[model samples]
Target: MDIPRSFTIRESTHRIHNPLDDAKLAVLGRALRPAPGWSVLDLACGSGEMLCTWARDHGTTGTGVDLSATFLASARARAAELGVADRVEFVHADASGHVADEPVDVAACVGATWIGDGVPGTVELLRRSLRPGGLLLIGHPFWRLDPPDQAAVEGSHATGRDDFLPLPDLLAQFGALGCDVVEMVLADQDSWDRYVAAQWLNTRRWLDENPEDELAPVLRAELTDAPVRYARYQREYLGWGVFALMDR
Candidate 1:
């Protein structure tokens, strides 16, 4: 079985499969207030950077699940490098249907809410893996200001049939799921630039090393103009954030 190419390639090259920034991660870790030895689940965990970092910094145990074998391998290597192999484990499996074997103190679906339909459904699914009153943190995009065009809509991860909710709608969904939005941190324009620009550089580096690879053309196309696209649409129109929710 293979995960989507875009995600797998990005994971192998960038160590992050999703479009989250460091500022967002820090905000999430803080919002969850992850205590030492807490059990955590990271769904669609990419290369498991956030999970490994949290395990190391907070003395927690984490189990991360993803569909990408490449990402799972990378996660394993990262765990070993961080000397947290014993504290964290990664599984190569379908994230959308996977569940923790046991309840956890924290459950997260950062940048992968689509796994459970959307933010609301994903929130409910993640909560099933959390103990009563436990935390569920999610990373999602919002609009700094409402978009005015098709390019803006595409850049924001919003399109027809995929209704991306604004921040207030997100909070309401949290409420519907019987959770309270306790904390949130927004990704500013600089952070947005960092996230997008980093992708271009990483893609270019990969292309440079593998000039004959099948993906070289795709990488070239992206490298040629990703920065411009980001500056015009994504960085300009979208606001991304990591939000922490708890039992109301």
Candidate 2:
């Protein structure tokens, strides 16, 4: 029903759980150009930043479903802070296989495609909640360059070389799935640094506040190795983006 305590602690301060910063997120929203009162369904919507911000800026209303109770609380607070509490709703539930009661103008699974097992399955899941001609947004990472070996793949936090395709192949995936690639906003190196580096700081701060906690050792190890691993592998070899798709 909820994420692990250690996971929450490590990303406690993150507003948008992925590499997209505020500016890039806003750019994606603008590219989509959802009309006022358009409905959106966001699965694994960490902190509900996308839904809340879209509700504020685009006058859309949406529902965000996530398994993390802690993140849902933060999402609700963010909605209220943005004066969009009445427009967006956050549900504390598993996002996997969850479909909206009504078809929505935009259906999204950002940065958590595992909810549907992988990119293909996740697209199927999102399609179930999308109206005809509606948009589907998927946030995912692609290999910026081919990893030299298995160790390089692992260093980029991937289990195997097949975990991600290169950028062109990833775009082709949508076409293979019967969707047209309409738009995309990619994360730059600076955004990647912000996302990964902030996690280290959050872990460090939590460790400082809870030195005796059982998870302290785990966080310590992560903080120690994360930066070097990110700088050496992911920062240069991994790229992330949110792509807009529509049924052709």
| lDDT tens digits by residue: candidate 2, 145-194 | 99998878999999999999999999999899999999999999999889
Cα lDDT listed for each candidate: 0.78, 0.94
Clashing residue pairs, backbone N/CA/C < 3 A, model 1 = none
TM-score of each: 0.90, 0.99
What shift in Å separates residue 168 of candidate 1 from its native position after superposition?
2.1
Model 1: per-residue Cα lDDT at residue 53:
82
Error of 2 at 147 (Å): 0.7
Clashes of each: 0, 0
Per-residue CA lDDT of model 1 for 184-219, tens digit only, reads 877788766666666666676677788998878877
Model 2's C-alpha root-mean-square deviation from the true structure amounts to 0.7
Error of 1 at 27 (Å): 4.2
Candidate whose TM-score is highest: 2
